[model samples]
Structures are given as structure tokens and as C-alpha cells.
Target: MSGGRFRPLAGVLAATAVALTGTRVSAIALPWYVLGTTGSAAWTGVVAFAEMVPYVLVKALTGPLVDRVGPRRISLAADVVSAVAAGAVVLLDALGALPLGALIALVVVIGAGRGPGDLAKEIMIPEAAGRAGMPLERATGLMGVTERLAQTVGPAAGGAVVGLFGALPSLGLSAVFFALGSMVVGLALPRGMGHSAPAPADKLGSGSGSGSAPEFGSGSGSESESGERVTPAPRRGAGSEEGYWRRFGEGMAFLRGEPLLLTVIAMVCVTNLLDAAFGQVLGPVWAKESGHGPVLLGLCGSVMGLTAVGGSLVAAAVAHRLPRRPVLFAAFLIAGPPRFLFLAFDLPVVAIVAVFAVGGFCGGFLNPILGAVSFERVPRHLLGRVGGLQTSLSHVGVPLGGLLAGAAVTVAGLAPVLLACGAAYVLALGLTGLRPEWREMDRLRARPATARPTADGPVSDGSSGAEGRVGVRE
Candidate 1:
């Protein structure tokens, strides 16, 4: 493959980085701003709930639309909306016309736009990887690295901006980042790179055994390893005769049958909730109560983010060779619980930073494994609906996490709430591991390379063989 083929992947990564960086910045800025202005942890949680609820709902409902309308268009539109909303917040605040209710409304708009925008970028990963001939694991790992880098940079910048220029400037910077992300997706990607994928007819129906669609790893028609001739489903979209409900139902049915996917989603729901609680409520509250403020909070996050980058790079390099189930289990063990415990104890700032660094490093291995597995199992065409549902479901608890944490802190005090959440994290992890479906993570690693009879002769889908592995080195 020529160097030019990698352009789509590069564009996606760039867009993801800047957009996520802006989000991370807002993560710090919004909570700090709310906490400082209102002096109420419950209000901070309410703001988080306002933003995330819309994000999850809109993302869940828009999967089929993404399939029909094309990811590129949806992504561009979402970012544009995000930019406008973020800018509006600062502008309204500057004019002394901003109210809490109005702030929540704007946050709702930003969240709604982020849902589809994030989904659009994600669904394009497989196509971009295929075009670049990069393996799924490596591609997702690089994506993780980009996210981690953004997390590092965004929080650090957010803290400094909030410290020196105040929260409004940080919000304005987020608007700039959103604009830049939009520009990258609109201009950097080639035509048709992020378009709706060709589907298999049986993808949405029960006719296909295992409900599996053909892998679009090559972004073109290819035979599967089972000697089955995999052909593209008829094109259906906004102009097509197919109705939206039918398309949506297909995705739902497909997701329902996947035991592994369901298991992953359930586990993620718990974790995302805990993470949101920590990031939005517990962390900031700790910062304020300790009198350390946003700078210390940002410093801890940046430390974690920096180490996570290193871990992601390592995962990208060697994840394909490692066992998925064990790595995932270990990652959670190292990454979860400890932060809460450290905070509950009110440890020295250096101790908190050190724990966060270690935890972030382990956490970095998660997305690459999960992303590769999800993409590899689902057919290319259903990426939008299926992936969207998966992500949306995983985030279901996010909105409530902050709300509950704030209420719990108010009633039980921060230390006890932190300890309770930490214990719950451990219990959730343990229970999730009891499921037998996790073995499939490693079992399916070589399934992509099975022999298939093509018109010429026997062939492979090029997933695991030398030809398929010839792309960029991790």
C-alpha cells in the first residue's frame, strides 16, 4: 500500500485527538466552574447528568441514521454543533446573561452532538485500518494512544487556563479545538472514506447462522475463511426504500444474540458509572475540600495521562501477541479501586499522583483489546448501528454516576462514599470475570484466517496471514 492510503487513518486519529482533548478540557473546566460558582456538589452532578443523558440517548438512537447518512457528514455536523454550543456558553457568560438553567441547556446540546460525532469517528476505524492495511489491534491501540495523549494535554491545558485566565477562557479553547477537529475531518479525509459500509442481506435477519456478517477488513468484497462467498448487501440509505425502524431493529437483534458483547456492555456500564462519579464529582469535591483546587486535580490527571500514553504504546506493540482475557482482567485490577482508596485515605498529593500514574498505565490496554474484538466480530455494514448501541449501552450509567455520587457524598460524607465505591468496583470486577464467554476473546483470534474457496482457489481473508500483517509496525 502507498503512504497515501494511510491518510484516512491519520485524519481519524487527528480528529479524535483534538476533539477528545477539548472534551477532557471541558471535563475539568465544567466541574471546576460549577463547583466554584455554585458551591454545591449536587449542582455539579446535575450538570454532568444534563450533559451525559442527552449524549447517551442521542448516540443510541442515531446508529441507523449514521448508517444511512454517512459517518463523515454526521461527524462534521456534530462538531459544528459542539463548536457553536461551546462558544455560546462563553459568550453568554461574558455578557452576564448566563444562568444555570441556560448552561444546562447548552451542555445538553453539546452532549447530544458528541454522541453521534463520537460514533461516526469510531465506525470509520475499520475502513481506515483496512485501507492502510493495518491490523485491527494495532489500529485501535494507536487510537488509544491518541486519546491518552489528548487526555494528558487537555487537562494540563485546562488547569493552567482556568488558573490563569479563568473557566471562560478554557471553555473558549474547547470551542477552538472543536472547530479544528471539524476542519480535519472535513478536509483531511478522502472522499468515500467514511461512507456507509456495504451490508450483507442476512445481517439484520435470522437467516444467517451466528448472525455474523462478512468482515469488511479489506473495504472490498472478499471470501470468508469458511469457503463461503461473502457478498455485499444491497445499498440502503436515506434515499433507499428501507425504513429506519427496520434497520434499527436489525442492529438490536444482532446485538441481543451476542453473549460476549452483552457481557462486555454490562461490565462497562458499571465501570463507566464509577469513572464518571470519580471524575465529575468525587475528584473535584476532593480538590475543593482539600483546598488543593483545580491545579492539583489537573496535575494528577495529566500524570495519569502521560503514563497511559506509554502503556498504550506498549499495548499497540504487543497486544496482538498477548492473551486478551488476562490482559483485560489485569488492567482492571491495576486501574480500578486504588484511586478511590487513595483518595478516601486523603493520602499525600504525591502518593495520589503516583497511584493515578500506575492506574492510567494499566487502563491504557483496555480500548485496543475491546475495540479490535468488537470490530472483528461485527460485519462492516452493521458497525454504525451495532457499535453505536454497544457504546450507548456502556455509557448508560454515566449520567447517574455523578448524581448518585453527589447525593451520597452529601449524606454519607466523601470518605465513606469513596470507600463504598471502591468496594463496589472490586465486587463488580470479580462477578464479571465469572462469566465463561470471556474465553472467546482468545478463541476467536485465529478465526479470521480460516481457509475459504474463492473463484481462483482457496484463499484467506488476510486477517492473520503474512499478507494481512504487512502493514505498519506498531
Candidate 2:
């Protein structure tokens, strides 16, 4: 492990923050632009669906490819594609040549690129942490903090830019950010930052089998002999189509056996759906109806984001000492229903801001918990494919969210739809929070002892091999 210079970790965080900021900014600008131009809530939803459908689908399918090709190249290529796609939207709109079909198509390209790009960044975290000689918990906490900061600032900046200069400028700025993000990833990090060395031929079978080393916790600062920290470069022949499917299948099988992760995925899917509706359609519609326009939209988002950053910082300091289950349940309880109800009641802007800030604060801690669990439990080599699968599964409802909310608003009106969604959110949280499997969240075990590395990779003393082991705490 590298002594505490932490250079690669800093670069990874910077790149992720910049890229996510661009995406968040685009997220705000795009929907507002659609609503302003079309004056149809339904069309707004359609545009959102166009982007997210490709995002979820492509992300799901690209997991194995990310594992095979390496995250750095995929990340660079994805950001470049995103920049071009966003720039094209700006160019076409400026030329007055942007048809609805063309706009949607370009947005689709942006979403497609984002899927793999985001996954590639995520896959770099543990590797970066290991290289920096930092604990996984601290590294992931910092990662959560970086993301929250972007989320805090991005939408507000987008809204302000749209309010003062129009949406085109926001789109142009998104392209610039994406371009910058690509440069950071391509040039800022060291050569071997997240690269994997190929596995020795004789150890291939042992590395791929179920007996591979069981992941304990985030590693100590020392390099293990069994390849615990280093991902075994999949054998060269693993590039075949059959090999891809086999690896993909292994990822799925690994997920199936982990009940806690599945529970998280299911809960996240519903939450993501509701969030999509709120961010893309409901909030903007409410702002317009209230005669607040983009400035107030920016204000509300900024307040929420700033508070969320505070919450994330607090989590980084104290999360390990808190009770996981009750805290999470309470956070969800505070975060979800109130925002919808505030909108449903047509509360004052001040009231909305206050509620939103509180909700955002509670919401910030959730991701660190999720990231810690994932990083600690998942094997190093499987990070890309497994992270992709889990994220894709959790995002499955995102495309439907905007579409459903828009259609509902068009048919029944906004207040009723808001109330209905709020009620559903409460029920979903309640049901899942009370489930037996969810108890697992409260019971994650710390690493017992160090496992020695073998020729096959880091294997627990009693385990057969490292590749096949899926670490699930009761």
C-alpha cells in the first residue's frame, strides 16, 4: 500500500465530483427547458423517460464490459461522449434546428454515456482507497461527502444559470464540466492508479472458483500475499463472449445469496422512482405554478443541498457509533413523506425550504451506510459488474417515475398525485423497515482476523478459494 500520500484518491474524488456536478446541472436544465418550450407536463415526462430508460438499460448491460475493459478507459470514453452529446444539444437548440426527436435522441446519448461513466468511477473507489493507504470506511465516507457537495451545488448552479442566462448556457456549461472531468481522469491520476495485473495462468481456476478468499473488511495498510487488495486480472481468454456471460452469471449468483443487499436494492428502487418524480417534474411544476420561476427553484435546491452536505459531514464523523437500522428508518421517514406533503399542501416557499433542508440533511447519511456495506462485503475483482448490477436494479423504476407522475398530473392534477405518491412512499418505507431481512442492516460484523493471501488470491483460512466467496454478515 502506498504511504499516506493519497494522490490517486484525491484525483478520483475530484473527477467524480466534477462529472456528477455536470450531470446534476444537466438534470435540472434539461427538464426545465422541456417544460418551458413544450408547456406540457406530459412532454416533460417523455423527455425524462427517454434519458433514463437508456441509462438504466445500458448500465445494466455494460457491467461485464466495465470489468473486462478497465474503468479508466471506460470513464474517459464515457465523459467524452457525454460532452459531445450535451454540446450537440446546445448547438442544435441555438440553431433552432433541434426537433423534439433530435433533443430526445441527444439526451439519450448523454444518459447512455453517464451509465458506464458513473459505474467506472465507482469501481475506482476501493482501489484508490487501497492505494492511498486509507481505511475503506473513511475513503467511502469522503466519497459520499464529495458526491453530496456536487449534488448540493450542481442544481442550484443550474437553476441560477437557467434563470439569468437561459437553459442553453446551462447546457453549454455542462459540456465544459464533462470535458474537464475527462481530462482529470485521463491526466491527473498516476499510471497504475486503478489498473489490474493479469492473473498467473495456473491460478485462474482457483481464482474463479467459489473457494476464493472471502472479503473480510477494508484491508489493513499492508499488501496481502493472496491478492486480496489487487484484483486478479481475469485471464486473457476471459474476453470471449462465453467468458463474459460466465462472469456476469457469477455476479448475479453472488447477489442472489445476499439478502441484505437485495433488500437495499428493492428499497432503493422505490425511493429512486419517487425521487425522479420529485426532481424532474413535481418540483419544477410547483415552482412555475407558484410564480417563482427558476430562481426560487435554485434557492430551494441550494438550501436542500447545503443542508445535505452538513448531514454528510456529520455522518463521516459519527456514523460508526450510531445504530444503523433505526437511524436509517428514521432518516427515510423524515426524508420522504414530508417533501411530498409540503408540495401537496401548497406550503409557503419558506416552509418548503425549511422542510427540504431538513429532509436533505437526513438523506445524506444514507449513502455512506450503503457504500460502506457494499465496499466491505464485495470482493475487489467483482466491484464493477456487481456495482453496476446493483445500481441498475435500484434505478429500474427511475424511467417510469417521471412518466407516471406527469401522466398522473395531466389526468388528475398535482395535489392529488403528490398526496398519492407521498402515501405510497410512507407505505413502502413502513413495510420494508419492518421486514425480518432488514434486521441484517443492524448486524454487520467487523473483520475478525487477517486472511493470508495464497497463489489463488486472498482466502480465509477455512475457505476453499477467494473467487467464489460472497461475504454476507448475518
TM-score leader:
1
Residue 37, model 1: Cα distance from true site in angstroms: 1.2
Task: Write model 1 residue lDDT over 1-474, tens digit each, in one string.
Answer: 798889999999999889878887888899888988898899999999999999889988998888777788899999999999999999999999999999999999999988888778867776787688776446766766776788788889998898888888999999999888999999988766656334223321111122133343322234556633354544554324557887777677766756877787787778778878888899999988988888888888888888878877787778878888888878877787888888988578789888988987877676656655564455555666766777777778888988999889888999999899889888988999899988777766554422210100000000000000011000
Worst 10 residues of 1 by lDDT: 458-467
Q: Report lDDT (CA) for all predictions.
A: 0.72, 0.69
Model 1, backbone clash pairs (residues 3+ apart or across chains), number: 1
Separately for all candidates shown, the number of backbone clashes (residues 3 or more apart, or on different chains) is 1, 12
Q: Write the per-residue lDDT of candidate 2 for residues 1-474, one digit (tens) a residue.
A: 444467778888899889878987887799889988998888999998998888888877787887777778888999999999999999999899999999999999999998888777766776776677676556766766677677667878899999999888998999998998999998867765555543222211111212222332222112246433333444454444446776677667667766766777777677678777877788788878778887787667667767777877887678767877787778777777788888888677789788878877887666655554554445555555676777777778888888998999999998998889889889988887777876555444333212211110010000000000111000
Model 1 segments beyond 4 Å from truth? 1-3, 196-239, 449-474
